[model samples]
Target: MLIVSTIGVFIAQGVQWRNHLQRIESRGKLIVAVRESEGIFWANGQEFIGFEKDLIAELERELDMPIQVFAVRDLDDLYGALAAGAVDMALSGTSFGTHDVIASRPYAMTRIGLVHPKTRNIADNPDLESVRTGLLDPLGHQDATKLIDNPPQASAVYDAGRISAELFTLVEMQDLDQVLVDERDFQLQQSVFPDLQFSALDLPARPISVLFNPREDGTLLTQIDEALELFDGSGLLGQMTDRYFGDALEFDYVDNLTFEKHLTARLPTYLSKFKFYADLQGLDWRLLAAQAYQESHLRANARSPTGVRGLMMITLDTAKEMGITDRLDPDQSIKAGARYITTLKNRVPADIPEPDRTWFALASYNVGAGHVEDARKITEKLGDDPDRWIDVRKHLPKLALKDYYPWTRYGYARGAEPVVYVANIRRFYNRIKKEYPQLDEAAEPERLEQLPDIDVPVFPGL
Candidate 1:
């Protein structure tokens, strides 16, 4: 009688577990708890994008269900929601060994570090007595705090707020001498607070993972594990990591801030001309403005030592071919530049696809179409996708090498210039889109023309 009762209990548990899996599939949406932080799960105002968000997208595809993300105020809220059965899973660069929640296999590792204003002179190994160090609250970071051997004499461990927000506040207010943060979060904050600089602390790497409610059956966790394994095995995970983190790791924060300042102060005077010509050529006005800023910082009278002049920095020969009588006139210069970019875009192969197609056109605008084709051929020869800009840019610099250049149609060209040129324009365009979100819909050409031109100093190598 006792053995029969034990078997009956096991059978009932099995049926309940199966029901949970069926319920999830029948619902057709996975409820995920997310916290907004850089490199984790933040929105760009228009769309949500981040490393964890991308991972969730892959999981959703694998499960054949859409993910409904619920925003939590902080990490504590994220875990609480999971515990309360409000969300099926949670992700916020969570590390292993977190209590209560079952953590998935680590997808990435990050280092804990210190960030301070670039203007400040904090020592590489400061004595704890000399400066105040800010740390995120004592709740979920006991492990991280234990690693800080020499904590500051005056420490402020925040109790309520996002970790990134707390660090930013401490630095911006100059309330703390330094603050501890993950390297990935520090890089994300650099875009907003460009003056902040980061230094890695001597600490063990934190493994980033997804967390699920402890009470849930193993089915959901199993699916996530299988999806992650496939993503890693197929090299998609590495590609995604490179796509998001590569630029941020090496970005020039100061230069980016300076360009942003120019977008507000200098771009208004010529925004109309760029929009006018961009509309005529069926291009995004911000892209044209980005290109103009890259070439001449939007100065109509700008001239390069290479004999390229005006807003677009067109050569005298090219200007004549484009039917522009006055290269220095902002209107003529912008119109000719748009036409030139459009011509280059049309010249690229039709099957290249967007973004890549646009990138190829930008490269051709910097160098020539022939040189770009050479780089594409080199990309294909090296077993990379030629249609992808990321792959092709790697081969662009090889044009300078004797072994590679001699074999290409374009005998010799400064191939690396176009790579930098395209990257700068893309960065500038993104900044403009973020800073002036209304520019596309609300900016009036006449109003922009009415704004007085702000005299911006010409920077070298622009």
Candidate 2:
């Protein structure tokens, strides 16, 4: 009788275990553990966005369930949550190893690389013995030690917590000769330190996967693996990867930090005026402020050697055309600059979309509308998408070439200036919007433009 009862209990437990997916479906939500990181999983203030977040969203859609994401502080915490059955799964750049949790097939692969300042001649096979490598604490001491067979005499080892912090240490403090970082991260950091150079290290590519509780039956794992395969087959995975990681390669760290600093130290004085004029001109106040910062660093008395003056850095003719008497006055200058940008935006083809249209206008604001049109023409002639900012930005530099400019209607132009100008404004505007989210709720301005697709421009005679 005791043996019969034991067998019956075992059968009941097996039947109950089979209801895991059904229970999740009935609950209408899946609890997930996620760590916040750029290109992985992070919250963008208003919404959760990142590569892992998108992947989870796909799973949610496939299962017809919503996800309730809980933030995990680190990888250890993510694994703990999965082991404890507190979360259905954890989405991160987790590698496969331990049998404690089942890992889905790798959704992405990334390799590590070494970055060094251009001031050093490490390009032609660097001397591992002399190079001082900086490694993030999360990278593990074993990996750091393995980076160089023979350790350097002087090395700075510290963990800044986040990738951006480590990058800031490398660029601003100049404490380390080299940094071991992920390839994607190195690409993004290159935008900040234009002089920095990178070389791929001889390390195996790391596989990124999602972790599920080992206690669950293989059914859940099977479903997730099948769904991931479907996503891959449909090319959705590729599209999502491109959308998040593709254009983030170029971010100017110094300029971004400077803009953030100015927002607090300088922008308060002109905040009301910027909003007032921006509202009148049907523009985002942050965008107008960003343009002003790009032009004059928000200096009311700023004057260029070429006679452009005031907060907006408007030329004498531009001021007159916009019907402004005193270009030095902050209010008048801002209002005039808004009007001019609106006019420039109007001249762009109507088919161009919102944010791209705004970028084209900013480019025109720097180099003039004629040169931008010439670049667009060249973009189309080259059989690229002329409406897209990414394609046009590539052709913009070709205008400086003798062969290319001679054919353009506008002749030769400092085509590179506008590209940098627009990029700077876009970064500034995004930072401002993030720092001051309340500004949007108080004033219903249009959504800010996306980051530009152009490389960081090296302006002439800066």
Candidate 3:
């Protein structure tokens, strides 16, 4: 009788587990459990952003179901949530070391980071030999360092405990040259030491995948694999990767250091105007400040070769239009610049989605809306998606080429300048955000502390 009862229970669980997709479909939305509100998944204002969010959206579209995601206080509770059927599945970069759950096909690979002092200006890729002259390779991964013609001698280790910031402090003072650290720690250290340059270690990486209870049906897993294949085969996965990573940009050591120094020195004097105007325009203050830095390095009396002036670098005509007599007045220039950029953003095609739309507007500020449109035409002519900033920026250089410019209505504008301009402003804005995170925004969403723990008695495995 006991044996019969046990077998009967197992049979029932298998039948019910097989209906995982049906359960989710009947519920109207898939309930997703996450460890925290960061990295893989995070909320920015009302809209959610991040690579995992993209994957979640893909999963929803493929399965034809909506998803309502919530986070667990502790990631360890992910197993509990899955076991209790509180959530359909959990998405994480790493599995929590148990055999009770099964992982979907791997979708992404992770890379560690390498950091070092900026001893000299690296125009493009630096000579590893010079940059790594005294860096202590922490993980002892020598394969990446083999790029140097002669291996960099291992330098003295300053025993300031184990944090990346401590070692980076030594690098800042030129006591050491470089060091390798975990990517998470490396990113955390950048805000304090923007002066340091960073690059990814060319090393083997483990693949990351979503996890579900093994008791669940094979059909859901198979569907996930199919969904991933769509992204992989379409090459959209690669494009998305480039969009999400800070490592995608070229490292400019000197420029980052200067931005860092100016943050302490000059930003304070006019910060009130920056914030006040940014708030009025409904823009991120860091973004406005970053644009100003790119224009004039926050100098009140800054003058461009083309006759633009002030911290915001407003042209004479723009200053007059904004009802300001002096283009060099820091207060007037800053306010007008914010309004102008906001106007440019509004002028962009309503169909274009943000952050991309705003980036287009920034490009418009540099060249003009007409030239940006011409670049989009060039991007489309070359068989690329003109709607994406990544695709559009690739063809921006053609606007200056003799072979391409004569054909454009705008004629010969400095096309390469806006490309570099947008890229630099992105880097600067990120640095400022890192240094000064979420300062005045008050309406940020509150993460759930403890989700209601459900109890499912008959479920087997984890």
Highest lDDT, which number?
1
Clashes of each: 0, 0, 0
- How accurate locally is residue 250 in candidate 3, as Cα lDDT from 0 to 100? 50
**What does candidate 1 score on TM?**
0.79
**Model 1 lDDT-worst window of ten:** 453-462
TM-score of 3: 0.74
Candidate 2, residues 1-462, lDDT tens digits: the string is 999999898998884433566656655667777655554565454555567877888898897778777655345555655666666777745334234667778787766666776666343554545556665323222453465535445455545444543554564466666776666555433444556766667777766677777666666678889999898776667656644554344475566567667788999999999999999989989899989999999999999888999999999889989999999999999999999999999999999976678889999999999999999999999987677676688789888999899998999998988887887786676557655654222321111122121311111111
List the lowest-lDDT window of 10 residues for candidate 3: 133-142
In candidate 2, which residue pairs clash? none
In Å, residue 131's CA in model 2 sits off its true spot by: 18
* lDDT of the candidates, in the order given: 0.73, 0.70, 0.69
Model 1: CA > 4 A from native: 1-16, 19-22, 38-40, 94-99, 121-141, 149-152, 159-166, 215-217, 233-235, 253-261, 279-284, 316-323, 342-355, 438-462
User: How does candidate 3 score on lDDT?
Assistant: 0.69
Sorted by lDDT (best first), the order is 1, 2, 3
TM-score to native of every candidate shown: 0.79, 0.59, 0.74
* Better structure of 2 and 3 per lDDT: 2
lDDT of 1 at 448: 14
